[model samples]
Target: MASLLYRLGRLSFRRRRYFALLWVVLLGACAFAAVNAPEAEDEGFTVPGTESQRAFDLLDERFPGGNSEGADARIVFAAPDGRKVTAGDTRAAVERVVDEVGAGSQVREALSPFEDDAVSEDGSTAYSTVTYDAPGEKLTEDTKKALMDAVEDGRDAGMTVEVGGSAVDAGPEFGGVTELIGIGVAALVLFLTFRALVAAGLPLVTALVGLGAGICAIMALGLPTTTITLALMLGLAVGIDYALFIVSRYRAERAEGHPAEEAVGRAVGTAGSAVVFAGATVVIALAGLSVAGVPMLTEMGLAAAGTVVIGVLVALTLLPALLGFFPQAVLPRAHRAARQPTAAAKEAAGANETTGAKETTGAKETTGAKEAAGSRWARFVIRRPLASLLLSVVGLGVVAVPALDLQLSLPGDEAQPTSTTQRRAYDALADGFGPGFNGPLTVAIDAKKADDPKAAVAQATKTLKATDGVVDVSPPLFNKAGDTAMVSAVPSTGPSATATKNLVKTLRAEADRVEADAGASMLVTSQTAMNIDVSNKVTAALVPYLAVVVGLAVLLLMIVFRSVLVPLKAALGFLLSVAAAFGVIVAVFQWGWLADLLGVAQTGPVMSMMPIFLIGVVFGLAMDYEVFLVTRIREAYVHGERPAQAVVTGFRHSARVVVAAAVIMIAVFAGFIGMTDSMIKMMGLGLAAAVFFDAFIVRMTLVPAVLALLGRTAWWLPRWLGKVLPDVDVEGEKLTRRLGADPGPPARTTPREESVNA
Candidate 1:
């Protein structure tokens, strides 16, 4: 693999123009395709094979022109203090607003509060329901304007009015501010790491180019905006990091006296191999989302995987080609001067053996000093392996304690900020009508098989009303054919409350008894029920998903490191980091710990898909850090360095770049927290926290400690297993041997030196 990559890198560097032009053409074509692609439609949250979904399908079948795919608005009206909404002018104002709303474009109908009995018991507040002919995202600006105008009129009439529901929902706000901030921070980190503008800018340039192409292709495929946003986030992050790794390697090779082309080849052969392996882990984890059987999550995973693949390709091909164009500029100033010595100066310096030897000694001393400083943290962990391991494990375990109380639910209007009209309306309805009034379950009764449909419908309604958690059951409304009856049941608890989830389960359980007695089929469903079903489905899939991801991690790392314990250690470390991340998410988002500091407007259950999604993403990234750091250690050990010395050498070569990459990843993920959408915010914060735990705590601290304790056993594999496992030369061992490069000095460590230096 290294030999093949080495040849490819040299070919790309020699024919840099052709590769550069090819990428440009592809980017342009993708952009054109994106511009011509049809608008992407949202598939909304739909979980098949669930009772709630079945009920929805039944509704679509029985009522062709119903509001199943359409939008709805609830205009909540609150009277002034000492006033009743049903009194005189207040009543007249409510009726006027409902009439105006009904007259708006795309509005199918708007029921008056008085006619629907939507007035509060005290008559202090009321609400009207407006149904639209299209989905919320498809509603015209004119229609939204008309609704707002009517709301303004009601307010002018001495009433406080707010519109909530799907019709009034504006969807997620994404203005690119967060992405820009992330990119900016990444640029700063790169510049600081490289200390050369040209070198730092190269990674950013390559990343942006690859990201643009990936995003444009995703757009061209007509994926939803949310998917594109995710692709952009993952693509930019991995692209920059991959390029950074390769570029940093190329500079290190050049600093070691390799010429431009050879340095590029070695860098691509070595760092590029690690990049490919790391990228595969991410792709596997993300694409594995298909096993969850959720269409939206599947799309998200696949899209992100594709973007990461593109990032890898760009790093392997485009980045090396770019490096070939500015070899000297990419190196540090000191290295550049040493690399470009004039023939006369070289001849004069070489004429005196003692002078040349002194110059060489000085250079080695300077390099040694840098290595010592870089490996300082590794040395600390190595010296106190047991204590370091214990500290990391205990600290992470403490953080993970909060995850035990994690609760997940789909975010609803109640989860929105108080500043949003949806939240205001939700609060008003809960205050005036009831908490359950905000989310009423619709029971679909199929009575066509019953001898008497009306009697069957009546029996089902009675059964629902008798349910413990049901607050009220509405009169059954039949379809035009009179074969299907729909009953609305309001629960006593809020939409996301635990009791509401229980209510859904109880209703489904009671359906069997109702069917036996009335010979009718009942499907309990609603937005609330669907949310419950989705959360349940995600939770059920978590273990299976974790199993698949962990298995993949073990298998992949075994191949990369060629060791059983190393792979096992990597997988366990990944789990620890993920647990810690989940703990932080639960504490902040669910328990409301430091919620105000993080700008959380309200706290409830964590988003249903957060845990599984976090596991998949963080697992991939954790493997990335693990592979990059450990592959170097394995490389040093393979080259005949003692296990202790190899640990120091690996950290000396890879720690700075790994830390920079991790910081870049954290910056990108953290940017998402700035988004106003609660789900996106949660995703951002979770990923950021996960990267922090994995990179700094697990990969940096725990990994070295564990490796030090294992010593030579860290790289061991059974002879039988070694023969069975395919040899993937991720460290460029074959390339180094083929080029006849010196494999560095041999290790001669005493027991005391091993204990102290390791």
Candidate 2:
């Protein structure tokens, strides 16, 4: 693998223009395709095989346009204190608003509060319902604006009015601010890590180019908007980090006296191998989302995986080609200055051996000082391996304690920001009508098997009204065929409440008894019930998903590291970090711990898909840090360094790059917290927290401690297993040996280093 990569890298560097032009043409073609592609569709949250899904399908079949699938809005109006909305002026104002809303484009009908008996008992508050001809995603901007404009009449008449529902919801307000912030932070981190403007800029450039191409391809495919957003986030992050690794390795090789082309080749051969493997791990974890059987999640995972693949390709091919264009500028100032004498001597001596020896010696001394400084933290951790391991484990365990109380539910209007009209409308409706008013469950009764359909429908309605947590059950209304009946049942709690979930379960359980007694089938479904079903489905898939992802991690890591314990340790550490992240999310989003500080509108349950999604994403990134760091250690070990010395040697060489990459990922994920959508915000926070825990705590601290304690056993693999496992050569061992560039003897340790390592 390394030999092939080495040859490919040299070819790219030598033919820089051809490779550069090829990438440009590919990107341009993708952009052109994107422009001509169909618009992206909104994500659908249907959970097939669930009762709610069956009910929805039944509605679409029997009721057709009468179902709740079409876009609809509830415009809530509140009069001033001591004033009644039924009064002449208030009633006139409400009627005027209803009329204006009815006049909007694509509006099927708008019912007045009085006509629907939607006025509160006190008559101080009322709400009108407006049904649109199309679903929310199909609603034109003009129609939405018209709906908003219609409410101005009621507001002008001294009545507080807010519109809530899918018709008025313009999916999360993403103005590109978050992406800009992420890119800015990533660029800054790269500059700090490289300390060379040209080198820092190169990664950003390649990342943006690759990301653009990937996004264009996704757009051309017309995926969901959410999928594109997720892909962008993952793509930008991995792209920059992959390029950073290759670029940093190129500089390291140059510092060791390799010429420009050879340095590029070695860098691509070594670091590029790690990049490919790391990328594969990520792709495996993400693509594994398919096993969950959720269409939206599957699309998100596959799209993001494609983006990562593009990032890997760019790093291996485009980046090395770009590096060829600026050989000296890509190196740090100190390295460039150090190399000037060597360049001059090469010119003066015409490849003389004496000058080359002096150049190599000077470079070695500079590299030695840097390694000693970088290895300090590694030494500190391994010095008291047991203590370090215990501290890290205990801290993460404490954080993970909160996960025990984690609750999962889909976010609704209540989870929206307080400033949003939907939230205000939701609060007003709850105050006037009931908390359940916003989440009424629709009962679909199939009475074709019954002796008398009307009697069966009536019996089913009575059964629902008798159910616990049932606040109100509407009169059953039969369809044209009279074989299907629809009834609305309002629960006594909010949509995300535990009681609501229990109610859904209870009603589904009661359906069998109803079928037996009345010979009619009942399915309780609504937007809220569908949300609960999706949540339960995703939650049920969590354990199996974790099993698959963890198993994959073990198998892949075993192949890369050629060790059983190392792979097991990596998988366990990943679970620990994910649990810690879930704990933090529950504390902040569920328990309301520091909720206001993080701009949480209301605390209730964590997003249903958060845990599984976080596990998949964080697992991939954890493997990235693990592979990049541990592979270097394994390299040193294979090169004949003692286990303890190899730990120090690898840490000194790879710690800085790993840390920088982790920080860049953290920054990108954290930027999503600023988004208006609660789901997106939760996703951002969970991913960011997971990365922090995994990178700084698990990989940086726990890994080294465990490795030190295990000593030579850290790299152990049974001979039988070794023969079975194909060698991945992630450390470029074959290439190094073939090149005959002897690593030389381990540097003699200083007294301070010896004491730390003792």
lDDT of 2 by residue, 232-329 (tens): 77898899999988998887776666667787888899889889989999999999998777888889899999999999999999998988887777
- State the displacement of the C-alpha of residue 450, model 2, in Å, after optimal TM-score superposition: 0.9
lDDT of 1 by residue, 663-731 (tens): 999998888888778888898899999999999999989999999999999888999999998998998
Give lDDT for model 1: 0.84
**Model 1: per-residue Cα lDDT at residue 575:** 89
Give all TM-scores, in the order shown.
0.93, 0.93
Once model 2 is optimally superposed onto the true structure by TM-score, how far is the C-alpha of residue 54 displaced, in angstroms?
1.0
Worst 10 residues of 2 by lDDT: 353-362
